[model samples]
Target chain A: MLHMLEKTIADNPLITAFAFVGVVIWVSNQIGRHLTGGRVAGSAIAVLGGLALAYWGGAVTGKAKGLADIATFSGLALMGGAMMRDFTIVATASEVHVDEAKKAGWLGVIALLLGTVLPFIIGVLVAWSFGYTDPIALTTIGAGAVTYIVGPVTGAAIGASSDVMALSIATGVVKAIMVMVFTPVFARFMGLSTPQSAMVFGGLAGTVSGVSAGLAATDRKLVPYGALVATFHTGLGCLLGPSVLYLAVKAITW
Target chain B: MVIFGTALLAACYLAGIWVGEAIAVLIGVKANVGGVGIAMIFLIAAQHFLKTKGLFPADTEKGVTFWAMMYIPVVVAMAATQNVVVAIKGGPIALLSAVGSFLLCFGVVALINRSMQRHASPEEADASAALASAPDALKSR
Candidate 1:
């Protein structure tokens, strides 16, 4: 069992990336909290750290197809940030005291679980609709989006700054793992020559979604609305991300 | 924006106290801690507005209770994440980092508090000293 586990981890680049990102997020949050006296500051720092990591990873990997992909990722991040800001306002406006609010303890838990898991289910359904046999790419992307975006947004809405940082780390780890595991799977699914590159793009999409969600949760009003906006933003980003990669490859070849 | 909001809230609360005092005199109301009480209410309300009511329970009293709940999740998450990172990084490094971070932040806050205390007028200091001492009496009793 130990040998098998080790092999699985070694073979799975996504898992390694996930672990790396998680560590980075956790450390950054701790540092930010110590410095800022608030979760908002910690979260902001984590987002900035994530961006730096992405840039470093891209450069180190030497797989970046072009400058356009980086620009696209940055643009997506800005859009996501704007969407989150709107969500924060709405969530803030709707704030209520815990005692007066109806406690949906178990129901709330169920709702949370459903919210986190539904994206993957939906992604699989979409992939099936598109006649894709392997749902790995969609699943990875969906999971990344849900975990990163919803976890932080809800954390903030509920005033869970520490949770936001922790969740961000967890989501980052998950996304990294997804990138490693699904890269080859997605390449095969799409009949692409470079599967690893596709995985990286998918990971980028997840990070973008997470950052967007974090920004939205900084204020209460942003929750539900931010989620909707993120969905659209990520959807478009995922579609365009690959196209940008293709153009980069073509440009390089020319 | 957040810093500005915090400052604005503080100003409004102070203004509320001044206004409350004027109203008290105009209506021939009792003096003493009543003005302070009115000020506190205004301060709490302002905090509620600044932090947003959504961050707390709907029925929460506008005071420490609200702040406690608001900060609980943040603390828990931070502690958990910090622990996880430390565990991952192994023993000594993680321990040092966590302890160091805490001490560093604590020292900074302590220094600020000390500076404020030193700058306070004698009368203000005496009142604050009495207030501080009063808490011990209540606790002992």
Candidate 2:
């Protein structure tokens, strides 16, 4: 019986992968509810947990893909690929109403611009302070401050080294974690009760996962509003990062 | 009906990918032009169209929402499993930059919000509270 079950899991890697993630999410949710009283979102905890697991997996397998490096877990690579990510991102459209989203108006647009530019400049300056003076590295790290997805996309576009790209991604991840943990704590101070404020907040924050989780913790209704605007930051950042931002950085440094 | 709904999603996604690629090509870049973003725009436009035409179904939206919520946890998992080893090996600079940039962003955003609040009226705050207190389901719809 045990051998047959093991063989089945080995043969159907995708199913096994799903099962593994299911358990992790369940455990994370339980931890969130019981320990944190839902103060911290389960998704944030789960993501953090998954990172720890990935680290352990990498150390054990001497592979970069984490648990996906294992034979049975290889399906996770496909499950977590760009296709699924895009599908999920698209799926969010079903919940959004164009007319309703427009309530935030021009202020929302200004916030989005500020969100992208401010983070990028800060990221570049920090990188410079850290002794990364190369234009490509600075731009990549700065773009990563825009969002994790933008970081890798910008890195690939500007011909940044893999290590530099990874740094950019890490920078974005740290930002996301901070947003997730602190948004609720600071919600009142920031006047985050309304949809308008939420939209502006999302636009300024720029990281979808972070803003969504943060807003979710502060107020569930605000998540959709914030995420709607935050979603645009990725596209805008990607559009500007490699070409305009890269050139501006080169002009400054070179 | 579920199959049709799924197909609708796939069609929009494929079209979005095509548009993204076309944009990338036009810009002389060698990557997809925010395929996810384009896909989202397509999905939103299509959903509105379907609703206006009275062809949108609750079940279909429910199915999409299920996938959408599922995607959230996937995002979290993806973050945790990212290439931290390479990032760490890149050194203390990356870590410092992340911390520094985050602090700066928080400060600037807070300042902006506070300035906005200085001019915001009590009625606006009341209205915001009322909106926030509305039923979650109706608000989502």
> Among these predicted structures, which one has the highest TM-score?
2
Task: Provide interface RMSD per model, one decimal.
Answer: 23.7, 3.7
lDDT of each: 0.33, 0.73
Please provide TM-scores, in order, for all candidate models, with all chains considered together.
Answer: 0.22, 0.82
Superposed Cα deviation of residue A44, candidate 2 (Å): 1.4
Docking quality level of the chain pair in candidate 2: acceptable
Candidate DockQ scores, in order: 0.01, 0.43
| Consecutive 10-residue window with the lowest summed lDDT within model 1 chain A | A191-200
Off by over 4 Å in 1: A1-41, A44-48, A60-104, A125-132, A149-254, B1-141
